[model samples]
Target: MGKITGFLDYPRLGETSEAPAQRRKHWREFIRHLGDADASTQAARCMDCGIPFCHNGCPVNNLIPDFNELVHQQDWRRALEVLHSTNNFPEFTGRICPAPCESACTLNINSEAVGIKSIEHKIIDKGWEEGWVTAQPAARPSGKSVAVVGSGPAGLAAAQQLARAGHAVTVFEKSDRIGGLLRYGIPDFKLDKMLIDRRVEQLRGEGVQFRTGVFVGDAGAGSAYDKVETIAPEQLKQDFDAVVIAGGAETPRDLPVPGRELNGVHFAMDFLPQQNKVVAGDRLDRQILATAKNVVVIGGGDTGSDCVGTSNRHGAASVTQFELLPQPPLQENKPLVWPYWPIRLRTSSSHEEGCQRDWAVATKCFNDDGAGNVCSLTAVRLEWKDGRMAEIAGSEFEVPAGLVLLAMGFVSPLQHVLDAFGVEKDARGNARAGTDDYRTSVDRVFAAGDMRRGQSLVVWAIREGRQCARAVDEYLMGGSLLPR
Candidate 1:
């Protein structure tokens, strides 16, 4: 520990964010990173716990205490090195990750946890400012080729690792751009796209090839982008020695209520990508705008919060979020759930942006006003008894909802790609591949990220990508020097 008594001296200090009203005017990052001195002070709060549960808490197994000590000692360069050692894109996780590591911090047992994510955010930002992040090409070529199918965090991490390990790596994206979900699904206000662009440039300099607008399976009507080029699964298997299925789980769950086919109802993925395209200056034939409309976002997760934020940015007449489950406690029972992710109410920056929220309410149907477009939503309040929910009597109500965004989360990877490659699937419909090997049933085929494990956080995606890259490298070269 850099400072033995620092934990007692310092309180947790989170990053400051712009007021919701001011930030909703434009699409850009609103959270301000902690200054060097404040970050060091925060890092110094990392106590010398006998066991660092934050190591296990972090999906990529980040060396939390080591980096904290480095930052506290004011060794910015070493801190960056420690950060990049495990995770390929700390910039992404630093901004979007929920910081489970902080929940698992030892000090959190009785006091505020160390501000790990905020410190990480500052470290990476400083690393970029000092030009410490750059290209690292392999000294020699291994003459092996790997095809990573997807350009999300997982695919990018796997591609970067494989390329640095002396393997030729080409990442194919179904969308017109390189980043899959990171560039599209997420709203720009949370993460600036320039950060992704900077990493893309670095990867290009390191001999990684990015093939955008190329779908690796049947360009089916469901989730494939417009004007995408189709490449058969067999084509990739034939061209490359190994194929890694890093394509994310894009199959969204549907709400099959009456009038779901109405004009104003859309999946979150469909609605989110268009805003991102517009932010990037692309002209859309038709844009889904929430401006001056009564917007209703369904779901209680981060995706739902993003919709609320985006709607607020669009100057919607009103924004309302509905969560099917009952609200959680304001404070977690830390003694019962210490060193683990606790069940507690989490209020994101978006939730603070003037959106009305209701819990334990289920949408009954979308109401139409003579026209084909949706006008309002009918819902009912529910009460839970023995883990079963029952509608409360006389609690039915209707709210104006000219626009409805379904943020219910993704169910599985698009089945077309899995079917095209003939990869076996688990009960959950994700590709059947064990974490130890990450090899699919098909020979020379591997899976990782949301494709293997179901829809998950960006941190888990990076962890899977790194481990899958190691497995693929070992399979190709009989051994791998890359970390798991």
Candidate 2:
């Protein structure tokens, strides 16, 4: 520990964000990391307890206390090494992870937990600035080739690891640009695309080949390799020694209520991706516009928060987010929920910008204003009996709405791809590959991330990717050295 009583002396110092009014102006990262001295002080808050539950809390099993101690000692380079040893993309996680590690900190049981996430942000940012981060290309080629489908966190992490292990790795992305959801799904205000671009550059330097704008199933088109060839499922199995499927959970959960086909109504994923593309300077010829329109975003998760932020950026006249469940308490019970992410109201930075949030409300119908366009939303107050919801009497209300975005979460990976691979799907509609096996029904083809584990956090995706790479390596070499 930096100092025995430092936890008591220096209170937890967290990252600061640009004022909402200022940050809403542009699609840029708003959070700022703490400086050296302040960050060190914050790091000192770690008690460095004997049993660090943080290891369990972090999906990647990041060595938190050691790094916190390193940060506290002002050895940021060491902190970065510790941070990167387990997590391939510390910068990404440091920025967006919910920091369950902090929640499980021993200090959190009695006091504010160590500023693990903020410290991680500072460490990686410092490493990048100091030129400590560099590509570690493989020494000799293993002569084995691997094809990784999808360019999301899982695919990227697996490709990087496999490339470093001397295997030729080529990542295939259907999108025009790589980085998948990171490049298009998430808003720039949360994670800037430039960061992803830099990481891509590093991966390219490590001899990882990225093939974009080529759909895997639709393989007759001219590809970067100048091969207008289609590889059948069996063809891929024969051509490549190993295949990894990391496609996202793209199947959106639909609302099957009446009037669901209204003109102004759209899925949250549909709306968010378009906005991200437009912000990236790709002018969508017929993009949906929230400007001068009232927007109602259904679903109370991060996607809804993203919708709220995007609508504010688009200069919408009004914005509202709806949740079917009842509102949670402002604060979670520490004694009951300690070390585990608890149920509590979390107002994201986007929600803070501008948006009306409602809970315990269910949408009933969407009506058109006789112009073949959505002009209003019909909803009803919900009453919970036991665990079911019932519409409360006299609480039916119609809210004016121009654009209605469905921000509900995804249900599963696209069945087309899964069916093409002949992979078994679990009850939740995800690939039936457990963390232990990491392999699908077919041999040599591995699955990870949302494709295997269902929709989850980027951090979990990274963890699954890394572990899956190790499993693949073990299957190839009988014994492997890659970290799990």
Candidate 3:
């Protein structure tokens, strides 16, 4: 409401980015946040709608209009405060989140929605540059302790909140590094790792302890990392008053077709982590490189698009992405789905880097090159009727590929970890925990993020983590001042 008619005067302005050809040469963030002037103009477009559906649209229920008005009024410091009040890591979400809030904007019914995400990106970055972002240690200690398993967004968010609530928080991570998925699963081109490092330091200043290379489960539970010290679930339950299992879903959905055992076929997780490790200056004896190879990434999602960008940077001969489902409409029926997330075709920056994308095609089998390596794949076109898919008659085709990366998304959390904790699981194998209490069946155990809700967005992970922290705090102190 900073400018009553600003929505009619201004159009949506997205952030600028480096050209694909130039950006593909290196592994670094290429997209630049909006400048102060552009951000203010964009924020001005926030219409004084009676109800802010963007609040419900955002997983953290970010005060979008409040920050937008602050930015429009050129109050950068206040805007950052409003942003950090809800989102623990706006920088991460600003970079990777899909911005469901924008889709739910009141002005989005017909005109373009305001650039809320970009404004958030600007506000946080400016806060850091101005030294406005700092540690907020608790004034008094609650004397309670918490053990958080997994150091991803959810676990980190929970640790930060509990620590600020005057509880001693220790975060356990299987990897040698602090960030779990953020440190490995995502490419540096999309999000710079230094951002995570700064936040880690901030949390450390707030009295949160990070125990890397420590698996909080059985040693034989098949942790991806080696040389990690295993701590039994019972030990954590005894050492700490409460435990929060915020470990993310890591079980990748596999394509169990013929020749799945081929050498060139790998899960996106395995391939992606190696590249990130290499980028972090860790040399690997054997790395999966898409260099000069015809790479076929199965699954048309953000992960697949990431593969495309990474492959392009690796100088792949070609990159092709496949989707089993039919393509969505470029533009959604906004009137029908206004104030809600609409299913529309989304083209990520990576997709624009150069990728041949196909939809409604299912891989039949991987063709072998006679050396236990994948050479090509047989696929069939499919048609959907009444929510059922049927293969088109005699439409099988073969595409040459030296590498295949499965990016079909994760199914659930590692069952062994949950089993070690002896927590009950839901039908989908996620830890059975209600949002209100976030308590697992086991005493003093809680679950949040993907561990409880199955695989989801980063923003949802943060929301669950914050709420889970409040639940744990209340369980311990019999009352909590922390927000849900």
Candidate 4:
């Protein structure tokens, strides 16, 4: 440990951010990473705990204490190396991932956990600024080929690893550009798209080929990529030695209620991607805008919070969010759930930007105006008993809403893509494959990330991708030196 009693001496320091009122005027990242001195101080707060529960909390199993010590010792280069050893893109996780590792910190039982995520953000940013983050191309070619479907975090991670293992990797994306969801699903204010472009360039330098606007499935698959060129699954099997399906779960859960067909009612995916595309300099003829409209976002997860943030930037008249479940406690029972993620109320930057949030409420139906646009919605308060919800008697109310966005999260990957590959599906409609080999029922095909595990965090997707890459390398070469 760099400082034995640093945890007792220093309080946790968080990243500074622009005020909500000021930041709401533009679609750009408002949060600033910690300075070097502040980061070192924060890193010094890592207690020399015998067992680092943060390893169990972090999906990618990052070397938390090691990196923290390196940072505290002012060894920036070594800290970056330790970080990149496990996480392919710390920038993404640093910006978007909910720090479960902090929750599991031993010090968090009574005091604030170490600022692990902020330190990571500082390390990666410094690495990029110093030009230390560069391509690590393989020493020699292995004379093998792999085809990766989708260009999200999972697929990109898998492709980078396989490429570094001396294999030819080609990533296929249905969208016109790389980064499936990271380029479209997420808003620019949270994560700058330039980070994705930088990583793509590094992957290219490593001999990884990226084929955008190409769908590796049947032409009439359920995806909305109408103009993409479709490649048959047989063609990939015949051309490439192995295939990795790391596409994200794109099938959004729907709210099947009255007036679902209204003009202003939309799924969060439908509304979010348009704004992202616009931010990327793509002009759309019909963009979904929350400008001057009373926006109602249904769902209580990250996606819903994103909607609230975007609406605020759009100058929305009013923003309201609804959660079907009861509100969690303001603070968790630390004694009962220490060293593990706990259920507690979380207020995101989007929530702080200004949103009226309600819990234990369920939308009964979307109300329609004279035209086909949604004007309001009817909802009822709920009472929970025995883990079941029942509507309260005569507690129905109407809320004015010109725009309704359903951000209830995704259920599974598009079934048509799985059908095209002839891969079996689990009860949850995720691709049926075990993590041991990441091998699908279909020979020479493997599944990873959200395609196999359903909806999860970005860190989990990176972990699955790295593991799947090792599995594919072993399957092709009969053995692999890549990390599991």
Q: What TM-score should be assigned to candidate 3? A: 0.99
lDDT of 4 at 125: 95
TM-score, one value per model:
0.99, 0.96, 0.99, 0.99
Per-candidate clash tally: 0, 0, 0, 0
- Candidate 2 lDDT tens digits, 77-120: 88989999999998999988888998888888778888888988
Worst 10 residues of 1 by lDDT: 219-228
Off by over 4 Å in 2: 218-231
Predictions in order: lDDT: 0.94, 0.87, 0.94, 0.95
Residue-wise lDDT of candidate 4 within 1-484, one digit each (tens)? 9799999999998999999999999999999999989999999999999999998899999999999999999899999999999999999999999999999999999999999999999999999999999999999999999999999999999999999999999999999889988988889999999999999999999999999989887757354775678899999999999999999999999989888889999999999999999988998999999999999999999999999999999999999999999999999999999988999999999999999999999999998898888999999999987879999999999999999999999999988889999999999999999999999999999999999999988889999999999999999999999997
Residue-wise lDDT of candidate 3 within 260-357, one digit each (tens)? 99999999999998999999999899999999999999999888898999999999999999999999999999999988899889999989999999
Top candidate by lDDT: 4
Cα displacement (angstroms), candidate 2, residue 72, comes to 0.9
Clashes of 4: 0
lDDT of 4: 0.95
Worst 10 residues of 4 by lDDT: 218-227
* Candidate 4, position 421, lDDT: 97
